[model samples]
Target: MTSDDSRSRRIGRRSYLRGSLVGLGTLSVTGVAVADESGNQCPAEEPDESEEREETEESNETEDQEEIEEQYETVVDVVEAGADPEGNESITPVLREVVGDDTLLEFPEGRYYMDEQLRVTGFENVGFVGRNATLVPATYHEFDGPQYRLFRLGTSDVPGRDLRFEGFEVDQTADETGIRVISVEVEDGLVVRNVTVRGVHDSGTWGPGLFNVTEPEGEGIVARFRAEDGAIHADETPNAGNMWRGATGIVVNPDHRGTLVFEDCSLGGFPDNGLYASNETGRVGVDGGRFQNSTTASVRLSGTTGRIRDATVVVDDDPHDSNGQHAIRLDGGDHELENVTVDVPQPNGDAIRIMNGVDSAAISSSELTVGDRPNSGIRIDPTAGATTLEDVAIDIDGSANAVRILGEDAEPVVLEDVRITGDATGTRNRHAIFCERSGCQFVGLDVEQVGGDSRRGLELRGSEYVVADSEFVTTHTPIVVNGGDDVTIEDTVGRSAGDGYSLRITSDSGAVGLAGNEFPDGVRDDR
Candidate 1:
């Protein structure tokens, strides 16, 4: 028989059995007996009413039990589990007793109070979700000892897996009140989202949040997390003697090993650093966030490999006890910054500082603005590795150099399609582009230093450099070969509206080759 015919026969048999069993009361059988052993037709016996009633009762009981289990299978509502949701009592004891692995603890719409930290570790598939829930933490003195965090999900040694904590509002607006809403360490798969802290962190304790992915192959994401009202100085808070400048907005420390991404977050002014993820050995990513007015730096990131894309860092206002406020500070690692916007109008440090021990760094499609300060728009350290800046525009309103390359032993730096337009009015007589590193290339540069009389365009002090396809407009000498050897400036245009030379070769400089260049003023060869 064909497969289709066999399938149709099977269907016909099933339909015949179903139709026959509908009339056979209290029995469900696959087949019916046609005759007895004597070859005479036999009739089916009827079921006893007592046995049928008992069976019906047993089936109903089984269904009821299954319904109860299905209702409480994966979710545990905290309010129904002896926890007060009206903020009348502490939920610590109830939480400690009810939380377990492979379950989700959900909070209904209410104000929940926490007087101590709730710690859970070495768990898998644990989650805490809230529906319009507000967490109220006790003040610094009222909280339990080591009163830093509201919830400590896991630790470095016993990290959890597949952890999720989301959808809660933290209320720390009371006087002398603050909290780290959630500090989670996970081995793999973490999602923390939509957690907002509603007040300044004045408790002088830990920050609003701390996240770490403990395994190298793990991954985590923190999205829409905001701590807009930042922290106060530790000395200004009730817990004065315990900590340094108060809490940071968010922190990921050196113990991190896995990749962590902070997405679409917002942080306000803080006493210490903001979004400080430096000193890590993992991959850190900051995508589409705003970090503003934090001491040290607003956004500091360093790791094995890191990226800051579509982010904004603003240092327009300084704190009361402010120190140096760099908009973005990158440390040892391979890092890239793309589509980043930085405004340091009241700058105390460099807008962007690439420190030593970087493997490779690239800043592309970025806009940087610095105020009238001594720091540079972008300062590359002496020991940093190969660096490239492409499609970058820097606006300087101070005496800061638009781009400063420091140290002779630094690797070759490349600046392509960079535009520097600013007035260097500080007394330092800074140039638009100042280079002390050798074997660098500046291509497609557009520099305009039209503010101060002593402002120059390109000051080359290193050797074996090339400046090509560039244009310079300045009051002083547009191109100055001060101490470089075998320096080439070709296919370029230089203009000076003042009485300065278009190109000046200092007496102590080495050989400089100029080709296919237009100089409205003349060149002065002092070599």
Candidate 2:
């Protein structure tokens, strides 16, 4: 196995839902039992040494017989079933005749040309294994299923379950193909491992994607996968009947109601998105992956509950003023992002984006570095529900604020132990943290502006907030309150390099209260 494949397997068992379910309360509709008092959502109690030894002995005895049966169980080979290995003719007819339920179909090492979309339906426990094989699909003009794809795993009349595809390379570089690599709809256990797609797609329909899962009802795993330069035509003018017009790499459709796990997958230079899971009722868990270079968000997820842990998202290219193109976009409620790093070096790139309908989301132990742009390090839009950001670090070298909260619907957002640093001296009203929403709280926040024309460290606009036990270092104003009701500032320390009030309240509102704030005697707010 490749090194990446090994890493995928090693992290495969550590699911985000395991042991961390309690943090999500009752968000999960599947009714998986709440974690025990021991707090193990996914218990990992291994067998003892004696039990291991007995199992090993039994495995040793049956290994040879199992291997014999496995070899004998090979139901069909495409080449033996009238498929041309020299890429001369279509293989769909021959493949359809031999594929069946509980079948182990094999494709030997050869270049097979496909003129039509290969589809299977009403089957269970079907395995497609390829050994050093490559599938070269037909060009757009000659390809069958113009609105379809290269491989379709199920149909509405006969939705397959427990389908596996492994060890193959789909070469779309030879022609201007717009076909999706593999599309599947499985009720349970959809596994795609050790697969790579090399090419660009120009589809007028659903743009070409490496793997597309329409409706996954159970656990879906995609590991050791790579998609290089597979872009989408979704953003082009007047999209046709192609449902996935903007799909790039792996897309789990919004109807999914299961767990989608992506491990050790690498995607580069995709346009729309990479590794997206968009079902509000489903769960997406990404571990050990790299996503970069997209016109839209690299990793966009909208699920009921999910986690993006130990992952890296970087925007190394010039964003070219692509608005709303974030490194990571999390629209799912009750989701968690831990130990993830996002680097947005583009001009208008945003490191992390949180949008509407997101409630009880948590971002902890993560670092986001944003470049010179008009976007914030993290943006919470209107319609955002209760959220928490703890133990997070943000570094910005831009005209944008480190954190920006907008609209009235963003309420009850908490920031605890968050550190934000700005590289600019002072930008007018550009703050380390800016809030336009009500009922927000900042606890244990540390903000510093080292250089540039940036002014305030924290600014509140028409919002009710409580600032407690926070520290601010700025060149000018540290905190500003502009027309907010029931605002409380307590137990905070401020250090300024310029002669400005540490606390600036623009409105003479009776709802603003201050207590236990420390500043220089000459520069303090004594009102």
Candidate 3:
């Protein structure tokens, strides 16, 4: 029989039983066959192969001495050259020769196209590995519903296990609706390394990396929307359209239970976001990735237990075009950013910002340099949660305030070792640091501006400060501690050209503790 015919015959039985005899039923007696007299037919018997095997082979001792192997889904092996695999020159025939409980399908250095969505189900360790093999979309414009996943785990009827899709590219051109998913369910670890996906949307058709799977009927995929479970790639799926986050690039959202890893990958040009993990309760760890020119933020991880380290996020280059954007923005949830460099080189932009219920983003040994624009370098914009800016340098090279901490009527935000500086080009009333309506602790702060448009040096309004041994210097007033209670400006110093006050304390009944303070106007009380 042909390979297709054999596959047709194997899966033809609706409810065939092939499990070991030990699992037949709970046996009260081990060897006794307590017959069921309910007119049920006998189990399928094995064909007579002992006589033919004895006629051909040597002895049972020789056969018994051979390698002992268990029966499993055979892996259909195939190789690839530069050209297509026809009947002779192609590996498709050999792939067809695999025949159900078959051999492995292997490809070495070439592009392949599958007319059917390669279903790798009902078998343990049924693997498809490619040594730099690219699998292009192979179908007409109308042949796309759920049959284009480069390799899948579960299907309409069959559940999969111990399967792997290693180092393969599911490329799309024209009607490349990406990797369509009836339900991509895997049993073993789904490892995707050194793979690239492009053109998930070709005009009318669009596709995502993967989707959740439900059961065969309609009662299985109900839990697909639960982001609290883990990543968005785990499900017992029946059909398509379940938690399909519109991701076109190397996206991994496996339903909160799937551990999707992207190690040393380059992500670019997806209309929403790159390396996106929204509402996934699992930890989305990203290491050594370059996210540039993404339609949204370079990395948008909204999950509570997500992390981003050693990454570069550049929003735009031109000064006139940021489209009113800010690079490296994290909103909502508890997270960490270690060794992150957010470089916003455009106008009307911010380098790093944490706002709207964002908390516990400890900045350690990282640089946030906003280009010469009329804005603050770094901002914690009015969130009730805790945002600690520790060891972060906000160097804005424009006439704008270097860093604006706008937590008006919000929670306390902390800033430590943050060197905020403006360009030495224009000089005026722009600020190097502006904190308004917020409560923050500034420790080890170095604020400098040479020939700039920084107004009033460091301005504060309704914002209490715990200033200790802080140095603020400009061509204007050194520090403005006004409109707050319990404000302390101790061990502060500033230099002015002429007509400039050393430190201006505007709040009435406010006591200024003067110790080791150097300024042009010496206390006006004539100390």
Candidate 4:
């Protein structure tokens, strides 16, 4: 009536210290064997499959049976129970074991305090399960490396391969990261589920969270070799470096397998970014999570085949950086964020921004706000990336401009059904869109409101841009095509640009594409 699969593996399996007691640092050994419960050659437990015979007897038709069930009999213990080796509750010798190949080590609930680093290496399919177990690092400025990343996996032992980390609570409360993996040597698969990394480090500003993906081809290796096979002279963009240069959180570097799953996790209150995955890190699927309250941004991502569905990203003033940076400052390649909400609180930083290096990132049905920053709400500097923001709300609590587009490699950026609104003062704080770079287009847009900031409605630079079927109201200079080439502004409506001017086009340069623009008092300010 019962199958062997119904039975569970016990924790306290017999373990022997036959491998020359490697101490606590890093254990390495070969051909080491242990005895069974009877102190003899190790024996494998046979499963009683008698129940399968009964199932076959009852059915007339034969279906494929389940494959052999290889259950991992994990060794578990509590930290307090194994605190003092001399005491009744001391760490079991089984845990300190180097862990044979394909071993599952489970720690019971409690705190473990150790001076040096505790490593698990030279293992495959190794499972480090922390069931209410906390690994506390002793010092701050004194870890194995520069970034006081407390813990590591897969060191000198061919790098821990195919590892799974689950139910572990790392103590990064006062430091930058709770746990840090130095390098995995070869391509390794890592799975981190149900974990929390908290605390704030002021010194770790440029440090990004959930970060470090390898660069497919940067400028590092080019310097080491001479010009040959189109390596150096091809992209001439002098390589930067190699693999997980400077970052925190789940990092994968150097031509390897990098895939992450963030299900029902929270990343906030960090000094810099919340979830940052970049540099040739491919194919990440993120569903359902809250990313907010970081000093810099909520999610700064780049890579290929990324889908962020059903999430909320809030960007506010950083207590550390009063300038209020972008809430979601990014430069990604072929990515999509659907059904997402990006809110920038009043006096908020840029809700969404794109700087350098991006390609084909689509933002659909999202919200972008310009809360309290003095700059634009959404700013795109320069890149050859094809980006789109569809059915979006650009609510500028009061930035001079709501969206600013720059020039870089003559890339094309699109805004469809985009709504821009701001406070009504109109004396200054003008313009809703500023086009800097060449080749940009905006369609199906609405603009309203004003502020006293002497800003323009829309500013254009030395780039080819197209603005069609748009409405604008109260503000200084509604639309102005500044320094750019092949510029087009048409089918647009504006209400007020307080005192300075309604629509001013100075910086007289480049071809202007002006058509169907409904700016009543179009002023060309020479100043």
TM values, all candidates: 0.85, 0.81, 0.65, 0.65
C-alpha lDDT of residue 112 in model 4: 49
Local distance difference test, per candidate? 0.80, 0.69, 0.48, 0.49
lDDT of 4 by residue, 1-527 (tens): 13342232111111211111111000001112234556574422222324322332232112111110122433333343345322223232434553554455666666544334445556554555566665554343334434333334555324555444555454444432333422332124344444443333322312222222122211000000000000111011111232222223333232422333343345554433455555464444444467666545666666554556556776553543434545666666566666677776654466766756766667787776556556566677666467787888877766456776666555678888888775623334445676665677878877666666554566666566788888766556566766556767778776564664555657565666567777676657443
| 349-430 per-residue lDDT for model 3 (tens digits) | 5566566767555566677776666645666667636667777776667676666677677776677777766563334335
Which of candidates 2 and 4 reaches a greater lDDT?
2
State the lDDT at 319 in candidate 1: 74
Model 4 earns a TM-score of 0.65
* Model 3 lDDT, full chain set: 0.48
Question: Which of the two, 1 or 3, has more lDDT?
Answer: 1
Estimate, for each residue in 102-146, the C-alpha lDDT of model 1 and write its tens digit: 567888899999999999999876768788999999998999867
Give the range where candidate 3 is weakest over 10 consecutive residues by summed lDDT.
Answer: 218-227
Candidate number of the best lDDT: 1
Top TM-score model:
1
TM-score, candidate number 1: 0.85
